[model samples]
Target: MKVLAVSSIGGHWIQLLRLMPAFEDVTVEFMSTKQSFSTMVDGKKFYSIPDGNRWNKYGLVKCFFAILKVVETSKPDIIITTGAAPGLIALFIGKLFSIKTIWVDSIANCEQISMSGKIATKVADVVYTQWGHLEDNKVKFFGNVLG
Candidate 1:
């Protein structure tokens, strides 16, 4: 199975990387904001998309189109993300394309699922919250990197 993992920098990126060993035998590709971020991700294919975040509305729009292009070319069978916003955009596209999607809300949001995670519940095949207390009918809690 081909899995495309997408996440922003900082904690989101770190958590996504920790999930790598789990995808060992599968074809995995990565998408992020910077080439420097690609340094931690060795061997696998990495596509550096435009840098964007919640405050950068313009950048997010550009990144959205860039993500669309990547989705078209890479044609990932599944998409997973530890998100902020960019990852959410990719999940939306992945859903529209009929690609399976997973949204792992950041461990930082221990009390509640992030806004993006709440939105993902409608589209993603699965939504995971690292905090066990947050688990419900839609979100699953299956431990985390911190554990």
Candidate 2:
């Protein structure tokens, strides 16, 4: 299966990278906001989305265009993301394309529902969380599953 792993630049992206080996048989690609992403995950297919910022209008616009390009080119069978804004956008796009989407709640979101978690839970085909209390049926307890 073709997979698009979407996440932000720092820990989120790193966590996704850690999970890569498990899906070695699937064709995989990445989408992130870092300008120097190629240096971080070399020799892999990658698309850049603008970094998240509540005050940067231009960044948001750039991200919109970037998302359009990503959705068109990747055409992935499954789109998975570790939380934050990028995951929210990817979830919406995956829904539109009828792609299977799995949202992995960030390891950081221990008690409260993050912005991405709230949105992704509403749209993603599967929502996996490390926190045991995310009792929603569609949300699975995947505590430390990446390791």
Candidate 3:
């Protein structure tokens, strides 16, 4: 399957990168806010979209279209993200296209799934949390990125 792994820079990127080795026999691409990640994710396709958050409505809108463009051009079978906001936009687009979507909440949200993660429950086909306690009616805990 063609997979688009989306994340912002820093920890979210680190979490997504850790999930790479667990995935096999598929084409994997990356979407990030930093073009420098191209070197970190060498041998895979990479896209840099505008970094945005819920507080930044304008930036979020730009990122939404940026993500849509990537999904449209790549036609990925599935879109997965360790997210803040950009990945949520990808999930929304994937859902619109009837593509599979996965949202892996950032490990930093040990106390609970982030607000973005909570929002994703509405659209994501699968929602994963690094913390066992975060698993509930909406979220699933299947180990963690660090493991």
Candidate 4:
């Protein structure tokens, strides 16, 4: 399977990296907001998209198009993200291409799901919350990336 793994910088990126073992048998590509992160992938395919958030509309638009371009070019069979906004945009683009998408909510959101994660529950094929108490019919609890 060709997997496109995406996330923003910081905690999201850390969680995404933690899930790398799961993609050992598959072809995986990495996407993030920072170009410097490409080196961390050990020569694997890497893409960089502009970072964006709810507070930045223009940035979000740029991020959306950037993600769209990556999705079109990578043609991944599955797109997975430990998200903020860039990853969310990738998930939306993945759906448009009929690619399977998975969203693993950040481990930092212990009190509640991040806004992007909540939206991902509707856009992604599968949505996982780190907190067991947050699981429901749509959001699932499958062990967190942190532990």
Best by TM-score: 4
Residue-wise C-alpha lDDT for candidate 1, range 1-147, written one tens digit per residue: 899999988899999999998899999999998778777877889999886777899999999999999999999999999997889999999988999999999999988999999999998999999999999999998899656
Task: Encode model 4's per-residue lDDT on 1-147: one tens digit a residue.
Answer: 899999999999999999999999999999999999998998799998888898999999999999998888879999999998988889899999999999999988988988998899889999999999999999999998888
Give me the overall lDDT of model 4.
0.93
RMSD, each candidate, Å?
0.9, 1.8, 0.9, 0.8
Report the lDDT tens digits of candidate 2 across residue range 1-147.
899888887778877887777678998888888768767667678887786555777776677668767888778999998856776778788888999999888777778657778778789998888778964676788575455
Q: Which digits, one per residue and each the tens of the lDDT, describe model 3 over residues 45-104?
A: 999999898689999989999998989999999999999789899999999999999999
Better by lDDT, candidate 4 or 3? 4
| lDDT of the candidates, in the order given | 0.92, 0.79, 0.91, 0.93
**Per-candidate TM-score against the hidden true structure:** 0.96, 0.88, 0.96, 0.97
User: By the TM-score metric, which is better: model 1 or model 2?
Assistant: 1
Model with the higher lDDT, candidate 1 or 2: 1
TM-score of model 2 relative to the true fold?
0.88
lDDT preference between candidates 2 and 3, better one: 3
What TM-score does prediction 4 earn?
Answer: 0.97
Clashes of each: 0, 0, 0, 0
User: Candidate 2's C-alpha lDDT?
Assistant: 0.79
